[model samples]
Structure formats: structure tokens, C-alpha cells
Target: MRIIFSLFLVLSVSTIFSQEIETVQDSAIVKVDSLYREDQFYLGLTYNTLQQKPQGVSQNKFSVGLSAGFLRDMPINKDRTHAIATGLGFTFNNYVQNLAITGTGEMPFYTVLDDKTVFNKNKFTQLLVDLPIEFRWRTSTYESYKFWRIYGGVKFSYVLYNRSLYTDDQSKVVITNNIDFNKLLYGIYLSAGYNTVNVYAYYGLNPIFKSAEVGGENIKMKAFNVGIIFYVL
Candidate 1:
């Protein structure tokens, strides 16, 4: 009887000891995974509009912009929810407006078409390399995939290729790599939302044209964009 009681007591203590060991291992695993990062890759599509437009200038059709890039997320806090990110990206912007580009050489004449002027297409396109730096804040955890986040940043873009096309029943004018455009573009942008989809906006800090003029007025148009952005692991 005494031997049987001793064996039962030993078994109970062993079971409790094993359970404590397992709990410690599980806690260690969670601690290691808490140092996770987010928003390494992103793709965005935006509706583009012109701000500070010259008199009589108006957009004709849908002006769209597409962007894709990778960002390096660096956490700044112990919880890993506050971070700073910087990355390199590419952007393609198409602006469809009534700004007519005529003549050639070092300078191109700019004219804003009136309602009486009939045209099939009048648009300008830009392909740019983008450098983005952002400050990010989020309510995220290692186990949670859906969380709220807000990211605001400044983006610097360099135009690698540009084109201006105007066509009508009377004539067609095509300009490529014109020096009139500002090659270096900088802007402020903000993105905020939950989970994968975010609302995004960008406002250009400088004019689109360097020193171009339309009817004795400086072409001071800047870019304003609003759209959706997605982030991937």
C-alpha cells in the first residue's frame, strides 16, 4: 500500500513539471516572433489631376498613374509598430488635358485649347524613378494580419522619359523628351487605412513646367493625385 501511494505522487509531480516546461517554450516562441516587419512591397493606382492650372486649361479624359516599389521597414520602438521606411520605385503618369504643344527646338509653344477647337487626343506622359521616405504607425501584431495603419511621406521623382502628343483633323504634333518639363519632381503624400487597402494622395510641391508659358502666363500647373494603394509582405 505504501509503495503504491509513493508511485502515484511521483507521477502527479512529473506531469505538472512537464506542463511548466511546455509553457515556457511557448512563451519563448511568441517573444521571438514579436519582432516582425511590414509593408515590404507596394503597388498603387491613382487618378491624376492638375493643380494651379493656367487659365482655360482643362483635363479632357481620365488621367491615371501607376506605381510599384519595395520599401525597407525599420522599426523605431520596442513594440515594432512605429517605423521609418525608405525605398526605390517606378511611376508612370498620364495626363489628358487641353494643353496644346506646338513648335519645336529648345523651346515649345504652349497653348490652351478652347471649346471651339476640336481634337481627337491631347495628352502628356511621364515615366519616372521614385525615391520615397515615410513615417509609419500601425496597430499590428505578429498574429494579426488585418490592422489599421497610417503612413505619410515625401517622394522625389526624376523623369526618365516624357512625351506630349496632340492630334486633330487639321494636324498632329508629337514631342518627346522636351526640356520644358521639370525633370526633378518632389511631392508630399499620405496613405491611411486598414488591412491591405489604403487611401492614398499626393500633392506636388513644384510646378510641372520649368519656365514654359501659355499666352504670356507662366504654366504653373502642379500634380494632385488620389487613389488606392496595396501593400504585400
Candidate 2:
């Protein structure tokens, strides 16, 4: 389903640009056509980390994930160096967590792990779709492809899928719920680099769970991601 969605997004962007090419007489369009490339798709792979997860929920430092999607870059002024990049994107994140969740509806919380809690594996994953609005500035001409650029923005996402897993010596426990998770997530991101390889970083602005409790105390966790962004233009 995700692969299909990505294809649809790419095709939709290509179709839009094709329509614009037919109607607009701007030199930028002509230059873009001459380049024989589309500059609207972005793909990223990132490392995920937990911030403020229940006091003792240990995590692997390098839990990683990926995201891909399309963007529309709309120039803001006559110089055309500054623009707003807005689009839909899909993201998947995985965290290697050691803390176990043991919460109910009214009051949700997590338990800390001690030396006695031996485990082979434990992880949490989430799939989401986001809308990003960015302020973009680039040093590029219609015919130039290798240029320095900076893009920073806020993104809002809806969680489409989520799962948790726990495994020990003999048994595996999979959890779809325990903590009361928020369906919506919002964050800010920044991407900057020359050419196609850009550095990407994101920080969540809201908690992962809604009014949840940990060891009888209200606790919240936010996510942070940093990685490389690839622009297939």
C-alpha cells in the first residue's frame, strides 16, 4: 500500500508539472524541460531516538527508519531563489525500547525494567503520513542542478499504523496498545546540503502519548530523527 501511494504521489507531481509546462511561457519552465528532470520527490532514511520516554525505558541509540514523498516548490518572488515547499510525505519510524507498557484507559503508564528483566528484543514502530510546509532558499538557476539550499519547516502527521513487540528466551509478546497514544503528531524539520544529498533532522513538538502515566506519575515521550535526505530530481 505504501509503495502504491508513493507511485501515485510521484505521478501526480509529474502530471501537474506537465500541465504547467503546456500553459506557462516562463523561462524557468523551459529550463526545467531542458534539464529533463523532475525536482519534486524526496526520499529519506533516518535514525530515531526517544526523548522523555518513561524514566527507565531503555532504547538502542541507532534505531532507524525511512520516508518518501513528493513536494511542490512554489517560488515566492521575482528573483525565484526563495520558495515554499509544500507536500505530502509518508514516514516510518522504529525504536528499540526496553521499557514495558502496563497501562489502562483512564490512567496510562509504563513500568521500569530492572536487572531481572531479561529480554532478547523489544521494539516499537509507527507508520504515518504527513503534510510539510517549508521555507526554502536555494542557490540555483533554471539550468543548474548542483546548488546549496536550506529548507526548514513544520510538519503535521497522522499515525496510520503502530505496533509494539517484546521477545524473551521462549516467548514473544506483540502489543497493539497499552499506552494511550496520540493519533496526531507535529514537528519541525530542517534540511540543508548541496546537490542531491541533504542533511535532514526532525524534532517532535508534542508528546507521543496523551496524558499518560508512568509509575503513577504523568510521563511523556517525544521523538527525534536525523539522517540523510535524497532528492531524486
Candidate 3:
């Protein structure tokens, strides 16, 4: 009788242990199915348009820009439906406006109001470090990465490198000096969509140049960007 009782006790403990292991596995699966994940890598490209161009300047309204960066999406709610997002990125802005950036390395540079015929490619491209902060809402789950989402926030950028490219039938010239661009830019943006494709819009809160003086008249130029935003990771 002692042997039989000992055997029965051992079986009972083994069964309890097996049951507990199965329970834990089941709970883990449930949590995985309910949890939502965020993609931290972002790639953006947009049609860029220069707004409020200095008077007497004409440009092709259809210019484009590209951006890439990483973002941190922090959950603001227990359910993971709301988040505050921020990231660091870089952007390129190109414009075909008929403004020539001319400056001698030793002197102050200025945007000379001129004709496109004078310079083969009279476009200014902006290379900047972009910082974006947004409030996000989404319907997402671990099992389904596809869902509707809306993100509204502001982005600020600091120009790390800037230059003007002017090409002609004979030669291409790059101007680095005497170009007076606002080193810093701040703007508001919004992104909304489902899955990998999203619509985005940005409006600048600052002028594109520190100062634009043509014919002694002060001019202010701003940026307006519209495009698509993509998440990589």
C-alpha cells in the first residue's frame, strides 16, 4: 500500500506540472494575438512646391523631394491605440524656380532674379536634418499589420549642407558661398491612411531664406510639401 500511494502522488504532481505549462503557452498566444506593433523606420517622398516665391520669380510648380529616417512610437494608452511619435530624419528639397544663387566665396551671396535661359539648371536643393513629432491613432494588431491610421504633428529641420546647382550648355557650377538660406525650418504635417500607403502634407512656419532682397523689396518664400509616407520597420 505504501508503494502504490507514492506512485499515485508522483503521477498527480506530473499531471499538474504539464497542465500549468500548457496554460502558460495558451496565455502567451492570446497576448500575442492581441498586441499591436509599430514600425520604427520611415521613408518619405513628396512633391515639393515653393510657396510665396519672391515676386518676379517664376518656377515649375512640380518639384519633388525625398526623405528617410527613424521614428520612435510610444504608446500613450494602455490599449496601444494612441501614441506620441517622434523621429530623426533627413530631407531633400528641390525647386526649379528662376532664381540664380550667386556669390563670391569672400562676399555675401544673394539670389539674383534671373532667367532660366541664363543658367541651364537654376535649381536650389536643400539638404537638412529633419525632426518630426506627431500624435498617432491606429487600428492595428500583431496578426494584421494592415489598418487605418492618422498622424498629426509638427516637423522641424536644420540644414546641415546646402548648395545651388547651375548648369549650362558648357559647364555646371555649384555655389556654396554667399547662399543665404534659413538654417532652421519648422512646419506642421499630417499623415493618414491604411497599410503601407499614406497621404502627407506639410506647411512651413518659416521663410525659406533668411532674407530675399530683389530691387530693394523684401520678399518672403515658404515651403509647401505634399506626398506619401512609408514605414519600413
Candidate ranking under TM-score, highest first, comes to 1, 3, 2
Of candidate 1, the 10-residue stretch with the lowest lDDT total is: 26-35
lDDT of 2 by residue, 1-233 (tens): 99999999999999999988877756555334432323489999998988886666777556998999999878776656788878899999888877665333334335666668887777778889999999988887767778888989999999887776767888776667434777899999999999999999999999877766657766678989999999876
lDDT of 1: 0.94
- What does candidate 1's lDDT look like per residue over 1-233, in tens digits? 99999999999999999999999998888444787899999999999999999899999689999999999999999988999999999999999999988777367888898999888999999999999999999999888889999999999999999899999998989998888999999999999999999999999999888989988999989999999999988
Higher-scoring candidate on TM-score, 2 or 3: 3
- Give candidate 1's total backbone clashes: 0
As a whole number from 0 to 100, the lDDT of residue 136 in candidate 3 is: 88
To one decimal, what is the Cα RMSD in angstroms of model 1 from the true structure?
4.0
Task: Name the TM-score of candidate 3.
Answer: 0.79
lDDT of 3 at 119: 53
Task: Judging by TM-score against the true structure, name the best candidate.
Answer: 1
Predicted candidate 3 versus true structure: per-residue lDDT over 99-179, tens digit per residue: 766554234344554553555577778889998998889987666778898989999999887777767778766776334
**What would you estimate as the lDDT of candidate 3?**
0.79
By lDDT: ranked, best first = 1, 2, 3
**Candidate 3 residue 76 C-alpha distance from true site, Å:** 0.9
Comparing candidate 1 with candidate 3, which one achieves the higher lDDT? 1
Structure candidate 1, residue pairs in collision: none
